[model samples]
Target: MHNLTSDLALALEVADAADAVSLAGFNARSFTVERKADKSEVTEIDRATETA
Candidate 1:
């Protein structure tokens, strides 16, 4: 019983939540960046966004 409209709305809500956490970190300049073993750079905001 999947509904297209509702699914899209849910997706948008998730995006908004992630954005909020991301922007908060950016605005406060409190995020940390780390290099993974793969040599890719990621930030605390990145991890928090995924957790959101």
Candidate 2:
């Protein structure tokens, strides 16, 4: 149906936007890994990607 096609297109657009934001942040980060007190690895890229 036309409505179904429209919905799919909108979903695809949103996915594309998210990917752009995530990848942009990923590319801007250093690869240095830092460990937290919780023994978890955290990077600026991770937070940026999640926010994206």
Candidate 3:
């Protein structure tokens, strides 16, 4: 069974992964934005971070 400490660790790990993807994209500043079917903006970094 999972406890609070393990759950928190997993959450932090996921957050770190997401941050790394986002920071890399922000630093590179080369990603293109596209409009989704709903007319919302999204980029490859967004998808990558979500996957992370």
Candidate 4:
């Protein structure tokens, strides 16, 4: 039970970090863009969000 609690806390921390990265990118006006293999739009924000 203690281990599960610790793991959940860690996951929440990671989520918060990711949210920060995503929000910053969302607010930024400029970022790179490219097409993925599936022909979908991709951008620098996308990469940063994934990394986070």
Top TM-score prediction, candidate number = 3
Q: Candidate 2 on 1-52: residue-level lDDT in tens?
A: 3699889998888778778876776677645667889999987665555555
After superposition, which runs of candidate 3 have C-alpha atoms over 4 Å from their true positions? none
Span of ten consecutive residues with least summed lDDT in model 2: 43-52
Our tally of clashes for model 4 stands at 0
Q: Going through the candidates in order, what is the number of backbone clashes in each? A: 0, 0, 0, 0
Off by over 4 Å in 2: 30-52
Residues 2-49 of candidate 3: C-alpha lDDT, one tens digit per residue:
599989999999999999999999899899999999999999999999
User: What is each predicted model's overall lDDT from 0 to 1?
Assistant: 0.94, 0.73, 0.96, 0.85
Report the candidate with higher lDDT, 1 versus 3. 3
Better of 1 and 3 by TM-score: 3
User: Stretches of candidate 1 above 4 Å error?
Assistant: none
Which lDDT tens digits does candidate 1 get at residues 1-52? 7799999999999999999999999999977789989999999899999999
TM-score leaderboard ranking: 3, 1, 4, 2
TM-score per candidate, in order?
Answer: 0.87, 0.52, 0.90, 0.71
Q: Which stretches of candidate 4 lie over 4 Å from their true place?
A: none
